[model samples]
Target: MLSAGNPYVLPSVLVAAGAYLAATLLTDASLLVRIGLLAVLAGVVPIVLNRLLGGGSADEWRDDPIEDPGDGGADADESREA
Candidate 1:
């Protein structure tokens, strides 16, 4: 069975397969129509689906980004001295 939460990989594969089919089967279509279809199929649609299905902000997937206080900047010392 296929897994569910993969927002990028599956859709991308489907788009690639669909592009191959379109290229082979859609020769009678206009160049402008083919370009537009390929743009949506390979670029735009998968991106939109990924964003819609990719739960949570990117920050939530990582450790907190706070810098260590001991990694002192000149500003830290300057403020203390002042």
Candidate 2:
């Protein structure tokens, strides 16, 4: 999910960083609390980014079906007969 081709990666990272900085600098939260905010943002930012980027399609994987070699096991059967 963190690959270079992923459109949401950069946005997620930036949002998570912003969230962390805001929680730390704008509030009087403790270290553990700020870390907890970061953790939650890390998990949720990607999902929110996905939705915002129009990546909510559930049938995306269906677009690419696995290719068959076209022999349908005939080559293996002929070799066995020999």
Candidate 3:
């Protein structure tokens, strides 16, 4: 039921729950390992969600030529005056 823009929210919530469960249930593992696993889940979950949502690769915005001001080459005027 979640929208595409909010796809990562569910995964993030799940990761938090999983981390809490691991801490409570797995007493033998070191704290560092538990933290590392949580970190990996946090990083990977968003990427997977984004891919599933059909997000495009990041792109730089470029202005269209039609949107530019038609200044009529002011530098040419300056050179003529000089």
Against the true structure, whose lDDT is highest? 2
The best candidate in terms of TM-score: 2
Regions of candidate 3 where Cα sits further than 4 Å from its true position: 1-6, 55-82
Model 1 — TM-score against the truth? Answer: 0.43
Candidate 1: how large is its RMSD?
7.7
TM-score for all models, in order of appearance: 0.43, 0.47, 0.43
Question: Worst 10-residue stretch by lDDT in candidate 1?
Answer: 1-10
Residue-wise lDDT of candidate 1 within 1-82, one digit each (tens)?
1224435546666876687577759677776776777666666666566677773444553576577666578778899998
User: Which lDDT values do the candidates have, in the order given?
Assistant: 0.63, 0.70, 0.63
- The clash number for model 1 is 0
Model 2: lDDT of residue 82: 97
Q: Is candidate 2 or candidate 3 better by lDDT?
A: 2
Better of 2 and 3 by TM-score: 2
Off by over 4 Å in 2: 47-82
TM-score ranking, best first = 2, 3, 1
Compose the digit string of candidate 2's lDDT tens values, residues 1-82. Answer: 3344456666767777898899888999999988877766666666666767766343565576577657867897898999
